[model samples]
Target: MQQSITPQHEHEHHESMKVFGFWIFLMTDCILFACLFATFAVLRTHTDSPFTGNELFEIPGFTAETFILLTSSFTSGLATLAMNKGKVKPLIGWLAVTVLLGAAFIGLEINEFMKMVSEGATISTNAFLSSFYTLVSTHGLHVSVGIVWMIAIMIQLKKHGIQSVTKRKVQVMSLYWHFLDVVWIFLFTVVYLMGVM
Candidate 1:
């Protein structure tokens, strides 16, 4: 007799493997971020520079950016819920909202960086500035990549509707969005809050 696999069993196996793979990838990314954060933390308060976080970081601007990102995360969650119910219109709308929110966050961050640079706080100014730019900009780059990924998925959804494969992709992207949000929370606490203090 030949062995047979049921559809339900196959789906469960695939999902389990996907979750495991995602977790592993997340852990590796965490390690990379940890190194960057550690470097920044060590150099953040270096007194060799005329410019410092107190002079460079505008708390109101960072607060707005944080709000935009957090709101985007919530919209991404709503998008995922809409996708699960096979409601394409609401899903697309929510995703569009998320994209807009993400774009807004990026815009604010860029403006803040420009202001700092104009005030003589370029990344090359000192070790503190360099590490600060690297750590925070790395996170910004990730958010930009996530936005591009979201747009690609939106296109895929339009072409394929809500098939199993598309559903799985959305599920994974949702996890990615949430992961980014969690990372931002830590970045805000560690980099922004600590720098101000």
Candidate 2:
């Protein structure tokens, strides 16, 4: 005879499935970034404009952006840790810090993009600019989505407290935040460091 499924088991099963589904989404995102990277690589050398990565890329600004995003990832982890301990205030506090850092990173990126555009290095300026804008902007969009998602989760946590559902959401958001940090590391190395060199 088949055993009856308990409520605890049902909850656990759903939680595990949510985590598994998030992993699949991340894998697809990895593939998407890979394709974007390949496109950027291929088209980066095909510039018709005077503005190139070597000329336009600012090392210090992107470096600071990297620092802010990486710190946000760390704070995201702290938020997860706080959730695991069932501390609502600290969890929310950590998430607030993470959101602030995320916003700062996005602000800096937009500033950089505006600077480039002012220098006539727009997407229409060349294939390189087109691909560069596409790839970097896509990553920025992801971070923006994550920030919004984190805020929504914060509201849920405040209303519901640290239930299994909120816990899973924190876990998923933490994972997504870390993934963005990893992607930015690559973007920094490939698009900025190598470009400047």
Candidate 3:
């Protein structure tokens, strides 16, 4: 004989299932980033020609990029909190801030890359430079895509208000934004700090 679940129990089960699925997704993303980092690590020391991290990395530029992304993560978190409170205006405002910060981060990244290329650190200069560009630029590309996604979600939130679907979307965005921040932390440590050392 099968036992029936109470309404409360059913809701709890659903929530648990959703959280479990989200955690699995996050783990998969972590694995993906791990592989990327490993590839970058292996390629970072391949200085067959000119254009090494010491020659290419600008501390001030990367510092600004890091701050922008970190602040965006904060704003995205605040947006999620505001949404939980059912406050639409603050949620939208925070999400807008997140989007702006994300855009600024990408802009700084692109500017840094352009500056490096102007200084002759083209990707073909060496395997190290190639991997450096690929790794960092790939992260920047992800930030750009996240900004676009945030804008679309913001529009939908504005039009529909914070319904269950919108709330779920915002929660997912929060997870993604935080995940990006985590990736950046690793990148900063591995690429920037390790390179300088």
Candidate 4:
């Protein structure tokens, strides 16, 4: 005779399915970003405008932004650790720091875009600028959305304490934050380091 699953066992199975589905979603996102990066690589050489990535990009500012994002990723990991410990206070604190760092990174990106525009290097100016702006801005938009998501998770944690549901939500957010940081590392290598070289 077939045995029926207990409620607790069934619930655990559901949770495992949810986590697997999320991983699938992340894989799709990885594909999307890969296409974008490929497009950027193809178009980066198409422009013969007076302004180039090497000339327009500010190394010190970009470096600072990179540092901030890496640090934020670290803080996000801390938040996850706090969540695992069931300490709502430290989790919120670490999440807040992550939010601030994410916002700072977005602000720096916008400033860089504005400076380029002021210098007459707009998206319409050439193919290179178009692809460059598209790639970077898409990443920035993701970061902005992630920041909002983080705040919503914080609010949930505040209202519900460290329930299993809240813990899962925070874990997902932490995964997203880490994914963004990984993408930025590749972007920094392809767009900035190569540009400078």
Model 3, C-alpha of 192: deviation from truth (Å): 1.0
- TM-score of candidate 4 relative to the true fold: 0.95
Residue-level lDDT of model 1, residues 92-138, one tens digit each, is 88989998999999999999899889988888888898998999999
Ranking by lDDT: 2, 4, 1, 3
Q: Residue 148, candidate 1: how far off, in angstroms?
A: 0.4
Q: Poorest 10 consecutive residues of model 2 by lDDT? A: 1-10
Candidate 1, run of 10 with poorest lDDT: 1-10
Model 1: runs farther than 4 Å from truth? 1-5
Q: Report the candidate with higher lDDT, 2 versus 4.
A: 2
- lDDT by residue (77-96, candidate 3, tens digit) is 99999999999999999999
Maximum-lDDT candidate: 2
Residue-level lDDT tens digits of model 4 in 141-177:
9999999999999999899999767887898888899
What is the number of backbone collisions in each predicted candidate, taken in the order shown? 0, 0, 0, 0
Task: Using TM-score, give the best candidate's number.
Answer: 2
Can you give the lDDT of residue 163 in candidate 3?
A: 78
Off by over 4 Å in 3: 1-19, 48-50
What are the TM-scores, per candidate, against the unseen true structure?
Answer: 0.93, 0.96, 0.88, 0.95
Clash count (model 1, backbone only): 0
Model 2 vs. true fold: TM: 0.96
Task: Flag clash pairs in model 1.
Answer: none
| C-alpha lDDT of residue 6 in model 1 | 77
Question: Against the true structure, what is every candidate's RMSD?
Answer: 2.1, 2.0, 3.1, 2.3
